[model samples]
Target: MVLPTRQNVEKVLEHFNRKDGVIVVKGKELRERDDTDVEVDFRQESSFYYLTGVAEPGFYVVIDVATKRIQLFAPPVNPDDVVWMGYPDSLETLQTKYDVDEALYTTDLDARLKEASAVYTIPHFNLTFKDEAIKSASTEDNDALYAAISEARIVKADWEIEVMRKANKISSDAHVKVMEAAKTGINEAELYAIFLNESNRNGAFFQSYMPIFGAGMNAATLHYNKNNATIENATDMILVDAGCEYNYYASDITRTFPVGGKFTEEAATIYSIVLDMQKACFAELKAGAKWEDIHTVALEVAAEGLIKTGIIVGEKQELLDKDVVAAFFPHGIGHMIGIDVHDVPKYCTSVERIDRPSYRYLRMRRTLAAGNVVTVEPGIYFCEFMIDPVVKAEETKKYINVDILNKYKSVGGVRIEDNLVVTEDGYVNLTTAPKEIAEIEALMAEASSKKRKLE
Candidate 1:
């Protein structure tokens, strides 16, 4: 990790090694809920962690471009602090631990900045330290630095890939646990708890995001997190979009499974379409592949599936051109995943987001490159909010099979999400949860047999 952090810093220096400027980045401080005694756990900012791999707060890094020296500034620990927060590492220990050229007390930061002609920081979402003494100092714009770092982070380092693989494994196993625990009578909250407990037991520090354990109609609402519904219909499906963070690297996966261990006819039909769409997208993932084109492929495949299933009637291309696919599959195909779930360098020199309906929400619009990890999640939802207005509109209602669509009004949605890393030849899927319909049914049936014996 130390070597990788050093390499990452060197990458940053490649673009900003000027004679007079110093690059400054601030780590996150411990934060508390507004006016409350409860304190949120401290996690170092992503950029700070990328450069220094230091997790503690009240720390900052200064990279001098002239000498190419890296200095780490940390807050001095007091005796009173030690009493409450345990023993603190000495300056020499931290210096050696982080492999920095020099480690000094943060109080000396102002004096150090005076030696440099300009101070530069990363763009938005950065912690900027303010000192009245440095008000007169010239501040360098950080656009170039931000773009450089973001580009560098687009393709992950070897160490990052390793951490992400582990995170995905933990998340994958957790999803399996939830699938086994799911049943017609279980509340969504109970399934959520099962996922959390499994992830924690498998060594996840925290969830990358709030778990989405939507049952029945709730599943149609993307990003649903209320998770309080009781799954009364044995035939309804459960969509669990959840993942955990391991060592600050994130893994995102979503699995939709039937509550009764076997998918109902309506649920199975939608699931097959979504699963096929995911496979089509996966086949197109490789180095230099255009992301927007991949999304277009997803739309074409989904539209074709909808047409085959009698939900929509039209030529595939015409349906896509008319934006009819957006009714069933509203969101983009997927997004990049790394320290941040939606990783940076979304648009680069060769690629930018397209303004079309499906491509607009696409998080990563750049061409694919080896070492880039992304999620291939394509869904087919039956949400009334997204479909009703379009169906009622006189212009777009002709393509919709209203009778067939009404039959699935209660079907909710089906999303098959998996994390994958782009390679020279193709992509390697990181998610290992059971996705095949037969596989899911068999796993749940085995769990039920064990439960019956226990009872």
Candidate 2:
């Protein structure tokens, strides 16, 4: 699986050379859940993985600036440990596998730091050796080191993009499988289980984040993950915002569909509008485009659609100027997606997040560039909490059509999200799940037909 090559380590070391410092990075360790004896499956920390690409716990990497040398310190295993956890690779095996200059036992890490003049390490809550290493040398916070890595990560290398493409393909296929199996009486948890099963069967070791399997009113909650509600086919819509990790890269996708295999009149109208809004945003994405501008375009498109459907009554431009669209689309349009789901933010040096209502929630505000991977998601929700309080306010009341809005208050929401990579001219969509209305209906119909034949 695509381990970071020597060239990747050299890139970070070059940044460290500017300050004449050495870098000390700690890998993640296996830990037990809260109070349980069971240990959670181990995953390498993202920053550490980006440099070393070693997945095992209890390891550290040191890159020396002056000498341009890299070394790995790994935990040594004894016969008893091997009896419990099976055979462990030798230091020579690790050095060859990870393509490092040398590998030594982690017990030597403390002594190794004594030779460094300046040291830098990324702050991590669970880091085992950060404090000790700092005390042993003239260490600093190293905000520059963090920024350097983050900036480098903004534009993915060809190999990184390839891994993300595979991740998106696996996630998209799993989403389709869940859509075909979804029905009226199934519990939200069952659908989540189906997604997990399919992802695991296809070789995804972990989900990028907790799956959002909301049905009906539950869909209105942005980060909902209870996944315990019953899906009412006659009235409810299923919104699954889930993705899987492949080779340390992440894919995030969201698809909203009718549980009854057909959208009701009101549901159809709202779904189509949300879909169009996403399309408008996609058209605006390209190298050199500001993320804020793309978001503003999405807001305009959604506002016009809401006005056409009688949900809001006002001039489209006036509604946008008043920031009234924030009530329906409360969150940012999307964010960068890669090693971390909400990948590194557009650092303050690039652009500070705007303070205005609709712009405040944006996660990335920098100009787009080629080789950058991002998710473009635009949605509209009838969230009672976010809408009702504003609706009660006298000054904001005139823009709403209360009668028409009430009809959809129970409709929950509609969101369509896809992963894409910026190209020289536009963007290439990595997600290939069927999104057209006819395509969704036909696939569900085929599944139903097969079920009937089996019975």
Candidate 3:
């Protein structure tokens, strides 16, 4: 059973049973985007997958409160199906694999759901049974079921953690391969393709998001996915921000490396600073530590290093107080990772909003918890366009060491990101890639020399 057969489904059922007489009915692929002329990957909804672990599309699950039983509704497979898309599970096989009480053809879904006094589902949307479910729900009881199950997924299970661990390891290895393959003259896309190939070879059929393969100052852009830039021959670096997914579990990681097989003086300096900040963040991770606390510390450390390096002329406290450090190191320090890179964390907030930490607002905010898996990425880049205004600003003009920062502007930036799982006392780094600059240079040099010899 690909789904959580051990304890995951049982854990969810236990939560659902809290409300007496509440029956949870999860509707199937009411929202599969039709395959069109344009190519698109169809991923199942994360919420649905969490409960049922059913990868097949166009199916629904009903958890009956009265009987304490689970049922799956799927379309019957025809004998001709084996000639085309391979054999699908028979009704008997489906029931056994899912460990459900029964598996019925989709034709019998209505009759099955009709047995329940209430139906729990996501709010009305343009899907197969949206109108029908809404029309049928005559009491407030059904609405409560939807809310209860939706909120139940906020916390992760041990099995879900295991899946994410496997995903993180596979994706992290892909990052290591990309570092070794990068060269100064290679097109940024070339490195991206290598990571993609490696990730797919390791069982990641889904990319959590489009790979960001930016080089030099292009790395300054928070979401640079255009990997078309030609890597400069000297003193430049490549930034690969990518992730892979196994089943639906995702791992997000970013690694930057010197393209010429060695970190230049400037590159090494910037790289060390960011790495130190990341280490500091990792050290503070624990069951109850507020993510914001870690984020604030990362910025302070980066700001202090930037100031000492003469990249910024102002006092460290002054730059920090005014939030000037964001010019070089912006974006969130981390985010929750699970079935989705940014897992459904709405339940953590007072009104179910995605709260963000200061200077790290792109990712959602929450305190560290035992089962939470997240990313810790801290970076520093001298993106000229980004820092130009800060250098030109009259209020903080003295703090702008534009000349020193310019030397490293073309040197690109350094970012070290890893997937981390919060533990009882601290956290475990799930990423398996090498983060040392020397290690990156060694691998790249070895790979490059081999390519040259072959050519």
Q: Which candidate is the best by lDDT?
A: 1
Question: Compared to the true structure, candidate 3 yields what TM-score?
Answer: 0.87
Q: What local distance difference test score does each model get?
A: 0.85, 0.84, 0.73
In order, how many clashes per candidate? 0, 0, 2
lDDT of 3 by residue, 304-384 (tens): 888878888777887887678888886778778787787665334343332422353645556667877878999987666
Q: Best TM-score goes to which candidate?
A: 1
**For model 2, how does the per-residue alpha-carbon lDDT over 1-455 read when each residue is reduced to its tens digit?**
43665667676665553545567888888798998968899889888888888888888998887776889999878688688789888988888889688999988887787667666777443334454444333224566677767776767888888899999999999999888988889999999999899889889979999999999989999999999998866568888999999988999999998887788889888888889989998898999998889999889988998999898988998888887888999889899988999887544565677887778998878889998899998999999888876678787789888999999877798889999999989999999998888899888889878878999
Which portions of model 2 show Cα errors greater than 4 Å?
14-19, 34-36, 125-141, 346-350
lDDT per residue as tens, model 1, 376-405: 999999999888877888878888999999
Candidate 3: regions farther than 4 A off: 13-39, 65-68, 78-83, 124-155, 351-362, 452-455
Model 1 steric clash total: 0
- How accurate locally is residue 116 in candidate 1, as Cα lDDT from 0 to 100? 71
Best-first order by lDDT: 1, 2, 3
